[model samples]
Target: MIWIIIEFLFPALLIALPLTLYKSNRPLMTKFYLRMTASGSARKLYARCMLILILLYHYVYAGGHFGEWGILASTTFCAILFSFRRADRWLTRLHEERKIFFLTAVLVLTTCAVPHLHTVAVTLAFLLLAAMFYPSRNVLSKWTDEENRIRWMNNPKIVSEYYY
Candidate 1:
């Protein structure tokens, strides 16, 4: 009984550590977020790589079946296609928020789908989920303001040299 309880609570405890840290240290997290978002292309590349890794994990460890391979291939192809698109220029705040929400949902679903949940698997899933959802309400507001300022400063009609 004790082992079962520990198995279930371990991941939750691991996830809580980061949440508490972020909650207690707002400025530090904001700075981290700014540094992360400074290079837009780098952010996209990191996200794509993480997604591919997650899919690969699902394919390899979860089950090496034909169905899993097909799902992995199709999802990877779609991810590649989306990455190549020039849609980043047109993304609004609302669109970005929706994408974040979608990613969170996907992560949750993927974690829940593991056939045999083990300690390591649960730990990895929770860590990934926590990292993905790190931005708190205060940090997000600051991020939005920073993004808007950058967009305003970088407007083609404003000037040639960048302000920020």
Candidate 2:
């Protein structure tokens, strides 16, 4: 059933994207989290609290992104989190260029609380594309000057050379 595609399967694949992409580095992520926590700074503690709230929202909905209420709540949480990260001078330009697509995806996910297969697929597809797009996102883009941007653009494309 197309319902199956838009229901559990799409979300399952969404879960899988981070699983696969972060597979090699989950231990490192844990380690980094631990290391950051040890400092016990107020900001860090607040961030941890927000992370917990995000989890609470996830749990409260039985982790259902397809339900309307869940989508609104989850998208709110995500937008808050993304704003905090992407507002940094270091994170700004990296997101500003493609902001339309990113915001569109967020809007799609936010409205997807009902089980319309076509709509859900579009939402899921946006998420899938975003998941794949993010890991390769240029973190250093904000630090570059126009000359650097041009110089970097001038080089012939090399996919294999670019990715580890």
Candidate 3:
């Protein structure tokens, strides 16, 4: 009975938590989108293509054999690679701070993929979900700084010339 409930709940939470976080972080995501757009069209197109490829690989090729853990690891690996190449200094800094979180998430997801570690995985996932809502002070400060920068960029005088 409890096992059955947990089996259902774990997958549901895995899907729901990320979606909730994405929705809640819309403003920040929007700012990221704007910054990406401002970077250049070629890079934007490359990013979109890479995203499509990764999704296709995950769903069509890797999903049945390796499950969600494969995607988590691959995505984290990609992010670590991309962080160094990002055009924005602030984004690079943010990614640097998140490297530890990304590593831990990968570790947890890998553990979750193991056959006999279900309980531990569930606990880690819950803890990680909680942590997502309450980021470290450095991350919070950086986010605040980015918001202020965006606000400054949107000033009447600056918006006319720079902002799209």
* Residue pair clashes in candidate 2: 66-113, 67-113, 68-113
Residue ranges of candidate 1 with Cα displaced over 4 Å: 1-31, 62-164
- Model 2 earns a TM-score of 0.29
Per-candidate TM-scores read 0.37, 0.29, 0.37
Off by over 4 Å in 2: 1-7, 22-96, 114-118, 121-164
Better of 1 and 3 by lDDT: 3
lDDT of 1 by residue, 110-130 (tens): 755764333234434543443
User: Candidate 3 residues 1-164, lDDT tens each?
Assistant: 54455456555766786686442435564454344334445334544444444444444433244444445655554454344244233233333456855776787788778854543454445434433432233433443466645664464233212222
lDDT of 2 by residue, 46-159 (tens): 444444544443443333444554455444544654443432322223324467546655666665544533333344343334433232234233214565444434532222
Report the Cα RMSD per candidate.
10.2, 15.5, 14.8
Question: What's the lDDT of the predicted structure labeled candidate 1?
Answer: 0.43
Q: Backbone collision count in every prediction? A: 0, 3, 0
Flag regions of model 3 displaced more than 4 Å.
1-3, 23-96, 138-164
